[model samples]
Target: METVIITGGTGLVGTALTNQLLERGYKVIILTRQPEKGTNKAVSYARWDIEQQTLDISALQQADYIVHLAGANVGDKRWTTARKQEIIDSRTKSSELIFKALQTNPNKVKKVISASATGYYGITKDHPFTETDPPADDYLGTTSVAWEKSIAQVISLDKKLVIFRTGMVLSKDGGALKEFYKPLRFGFATILGSGDQYISWIHIQDLVRLYFNAIVNDRLEGIYNAVAPNPVTHKELVLAMAHAAKGRSYVTSYVPAFALKLALGEMSIEVLKSVNASSRKIQDTGFQFSYPTVQEAMEQLFK
Candidate 1:
């Protein structure tokens, strides 16, 4: 079995991906700030601190692959200048640390799979974005550009690199769906802006499977959008969540952009922005999505 090193092993996606990798018989190693906190019998933990720029290079010395998922939570706070810097630095610095570690060590690590986001496309209101689309010029776009570029340094070391531009992941435990549904538990779900903005989402299971696929499938390289085939409008997404939660089908009220801006600051734009991403590139590689539609994905999540 191949040994794989994964950063961000404590996150929602990381936790799910670690279990899946372990179940598939891969020797999983997790990089964490606190090694003692990671108690997975199937996973070996190593210490890494992004702020201090320290890593256990010995962990990568024999790993077959590295999955870079370490980053500060984007939606965790309002996007103040300081908070925005934290987001950008957390992503780029972590990727730089990983790349440098890999380069300094004469390791057998052959491939590196890093995390990006559909936020790379910025606030697109019209066209559905593909991996081939040029990155946007906004804050999220610039951050993703720098984040992805930081990983490109690993490619220079002759490591085959794959970047997963992820979408809003839907899971029963956590993620945007949980945040979206939490408000609905109070008997009302408010749609931001016009509610016509498209939301591209995927099941957590599908995303984990996609990461695993990137590990084994040598043909998978470059940037691939990790999203479902069918995208939903904000209105449809709220209704689907309500349907999933067995809530009454009430009218979806709009939260005006001005209010969202005042409330969430710069983060409000992310909440209100329209982004429809295409996952055809990854699906073309013979990888099947378990939840291709929002309705189906939400149903599975709610179940």
Candidate 2:
């Protein structure tokens, strides 16, 4: 069995991906800040501090693949000046650390798959974004652009590099969907701005499958939008969640743009803006989505 080294293995996506990899017979090693916390028999943990640039060199010795998912939570707090720096530094420094580790011990890993986000596109009106679409001009966009660029350094090592430009991931356990529904359970849902802003989302299961596909398929390189084929508006998504919860809930009113701006600052655009992403790149790579529509996905989660 091949060995895969994963960073941020305790996160929502990382936890799911680690289980899937282990189930499929891959030996998993996770780069964690707390090595003692990783008790799973299938997983071995290594300690690394990106800020200090310290890593256990042995961790990369037999890594067949490296899945980079380490980063500070974006929506966990308001994007203050320090918080913004934390987000950017966490991503860039972690990637740089990984790349440096690879450089120190060349040919240890076969491929490096790093995490990017749909925030790369920032706030767009209605233009459907593709891999070729230029990144938007916003704080999130700058953060994502810098995040991806930091990982691009690994390409010089001649290893296969795949970047997943993920969208809003819908899952019952955690992520934006659960938070979005928590408010609806009180019998009302608030739409941000016009609520017509398109939200490109992918089921957690599908996103993990995409990662596996990229790992096994050698042809999968460069960037791919990890989003559903049918993107829905903010209103449509909130309504679907309310329906799934079977709550007597309705979108009462729009949260004005100014209010969001005042509340979230630079992060407000992430919630108030729209970007319909095209998934043709991944589809053309021969990956079939298990859940294509928001209704089907929500049904599975809610049922």
Candidate 3:
């Protein structure tokens, strides 16, 4: 069995990915900042500090493949200049550390799969963003592009590098679905801004499987959008979530755009930006999405 070392394996997606990797009979190695998190017997762990540029080289020595997923959560805090830099560095610097480790250490690592975001295409209200679209000039666009470029450097060493420009991931345990489901129980969910922003999303199951596909499918290279084909507006998304969660509905009211701007600061724009993303490129690779529609995806989650 091949060994796969996943950076940021303690995160929500990483936690799930670690399990899926183990079930497939591959030896799992996780690089984490926290020691207690590496307690899983089925998975091995190494410690790394991206800012300090410290890492345990032994993990890379044994890794056959590496899935780069470590990054600061964009939604966790207000996007001040320092916070923005933190977000960018957390991703790019962590990746640089891995690349440096690979270059300096004797390793058998063959391939690298890194997680990116649909934000690369910026806030597209009309045009359906595809992998071929140029990276936007906005903060997210530039940050994401930088993130991808950092990981893409590994390709120069003749190793396979695959980047997934992921969209909003819908999962019951955590992520956007959990936040959307929270307000549904209170009679009405808070719809962001005008509630017209197009949310290109994917079921967590499909996203996980896509990662597995990237690992095994030698044909898949470059950036592929990890999203459901049927992207929906904010209104439709919240309503669908409300219906799924106990058949309740959002009180036909939206949180004002200005109020959101005031509350969330610059982050509000990101929350409300319409992103019409595409998953066709990934689909063309013969990997079918298990949840192709929002309704089917949400129903399964809420059921």
Candidate 4:
């Protein structure tokens, strides 16, 4: 059986992808920071301390593909200077560690697929960002660029490389939806800022499916925006979820821009930034989204 090594194999995306791969009869190896807690016999685990920059070389040797999902959650904490450094290192440094393992060890690994973000385009008010556009000169863009560049070692080693610039992923379990759902469960929706900033979102199912496609479809290389083509303004997304909830006394209101700025400080730029990314490149590969629109995505999540 072909083995796939995934870094950060316990995060939201990693956990879901692990099940999908195992169900398909693929050997899934998780490169984790806490190997002692890994109990699933169906999958294997290798311990790696990113902070210490160490890895189990066998994890690199036994893989046909590498899915690099290891990254700090940018929204989990306020974007202090230290937190910013952690976000960049979690991605780039982990990538460097994987590359180092491959350098020192004899391995037959063929492909390296890494996670990236739509933040590569910076905070644009209008124009939808495409893969062909140049990187934005901002913190998010710089970090994403560095993260992507760190994987150059894979391509340099003559392996297939795929990098996906993902947008906000909507999952019923957790992530952006969880944050949005809490307020909605109380019969109200809190829209951020002017609430007109475009939100490029994809269902968690679609996002994971895209990763599957990247592994199986050799043609999908370089960078592709992993977002639903039907990007909506923030207000539209909030109301759509409220409608989907089918709950009593549903009310949608804007949380003033000043309040969000005050509360989030530097991190507020993420929520208030407009992101309109296109998924045309991925779709051209004959890929179809299970949830192409927010209403469809929300309906399924609520169901």
Candidate 5:
């Protein structure tokens, strides 16, 4: 059986992707800072220290493929100077560790798949951004550029590489959806800013499937936007989500940009940013999205 080693395999995307890989009969090794014995026979955990820049070399030698998803949650905290550094370091450092391990070790790793964010396109854009667009000169863009660059070094090692620029991942379990669902319990459909900002999103299941597709489909190289076909405005998304949850019982309320800025500080820029990214490139590869629209995704998640 083919073996795939994943960094940050305990996160939402990683956990979902792990189940997918295991169900398909692939051996899964999760590289974690804290190694633990897994209950599943097909799953195991290895040690990787980003601080010391160390990795379990034995894991690298056994991996047929590598999926790099280790990174700090950018929205998890206020973006203080130190927090911003942590965000960049978490992604780039982990990537550096993976690349270094693969470089020094004699391994059979054929392809490497890494996750990047749609923030590479910048905070807001009117037109749909493609993979060819230049990385914006902002914090998010620069962070993504550096993170991808760290992983891109694997190409020099003659290993195939695939990088996915992901958008907002909507999952019923946790993530953006859970936060969106928060106000709904009290019958409030809280809309952020003007609520017209476009939200490029993909279902958690679909996102995991995209990773699986890259693993099996060799044609997928370079970068592709991991978003649903149809992007929705923030207002439309909240209304649909509210409809799914409480029919028409929820009250639609707008949260001013200033309020969000005050509450979130600098991180509010991302919460209010309108990023319309295209999935055309991935779709052209004959890859279909199981949940191509927000409405459909909401129905599935709420049903």
Candidate 6:
């Protein structure tokens, strides 16, 4: 059986992807700082330390493909100067560790697929940012540029690389979806900022399937934006969620941009930034989205 090595395998996206890979009959090896044994015979864990710059050599040799997902949560904490550095380092350094391992070790790994953010395109007003668009000059943009650059080195090792500049992923288990539901519990549909910023989002199922397709489809090389075809504004998204959760029996409240800035600090820039990214490139590959609209995605999740 072909083996796939995944970094950040315990995360929201990583956990879902692992289950999908196993369903496809692929042996899965997750690289973590603290490795442990799992009950599944096809699933195992290996050790990798970013600070030490080390990975299990045996695991690397066994990998037919490597999915890079290791990184700190951008929205989890206040973006302090130190925390911002940690956020950038977790992605760049972890990728560098993988590249170094592939460079110094003898591995037959064929392809390397990694996760990126729609922030790569920075803040776009109405125009849908495409794959060919230049990386933004802002914090998220520069950080994404550095993150991609670290993994781009693997291309020199003759490994095929595919990076997905993903947007907000809406999942039922956990993520922005859970947080969005919080206000609904109080019967308030809260809108952030002017509620005009566009939010590019994809359902968890489609996002995981995109990664799986990248692993199996050789035609999907280079960067592709992972988002739904029809982008919605922040207002449209929250209202839709409110409708999904409580029909039309909910109060609408707008959270001013100033309040968000005071609360989220530097991170609020991301929450308020309007990023209307396109998925046409990936769609051109003939991949169909199961949940193409916000209503469709919300219906399934809320059901």
TM-score of each: 0.96, 0.96, 0.97, 0.97, 0.97, 0.97
- Per-residue alpha-carbon lDDT of model 3 for 199-282, expressed as tens digits? 999998899998999889887788899999899999888888777776754465578999999999989888988999988888
Instruction: Say which prediction, candidate 5 or candidate 6, comes out ahead on lDDT.
Output: 6
Better of 1 and 2 by lDDT: 2
Candidate 6 residues lying further than 4 Å off, grouped into runs, are 37-42
Best-matching candidate per lDDT: 6
lDDT tens per residue, model 5, 1-303:
999999889888999999999999999999987787555556889998999999888888899999999999988889999999999999999988888888888999999999999999975556799989888888899999999999999999999999999999998788888999999999999999999999999999999999999999987898999999999999999898999878989899889999999999988988888899999999999999999989899999898
Candidate that beats the other on TM-score, 3 or 5, i.e. the better one = 5
Q: Any residue pairs clashing in model 5, and if so which?
A: none
Worst 10 residues of 3 by lDDT: 245-254
- Alpha carbon deviation, residue 213, candidate 2 (Å): 0.6
Winner of 2 and 4 under TM-score? 4
Candidate 3 ranges beyond 4 A from true positions: none
lDDT value, residue 232 of candidate 1: 90
How do the residues 190-293 of candidate 1 rate in per-residue lDDT, one tens digit apiece?
78788888888888999999999999999889999999999899889888888877756555567798998999998887888889999888988999998888
Give a tens-digit lDDT track for model 4, residues 198-286. 99999999999999998888787888999998999999998888888854568777898889989999888878989899899888989
Off by over 4 Å in 1: 247-251
What C-alpha RMSD separates each model from the true structure? 1.4, 1.5, 1.3, 1.2, 1.2, 1.3
Residue pairs in candidate 6 whose N, alpha carbon or C atoms collide under 3 angstroms: none
TM-score of structure candidate 1: 0.96
lDDT of 6 at 292: 98
Error of 1 at 260 (Å): 1.2
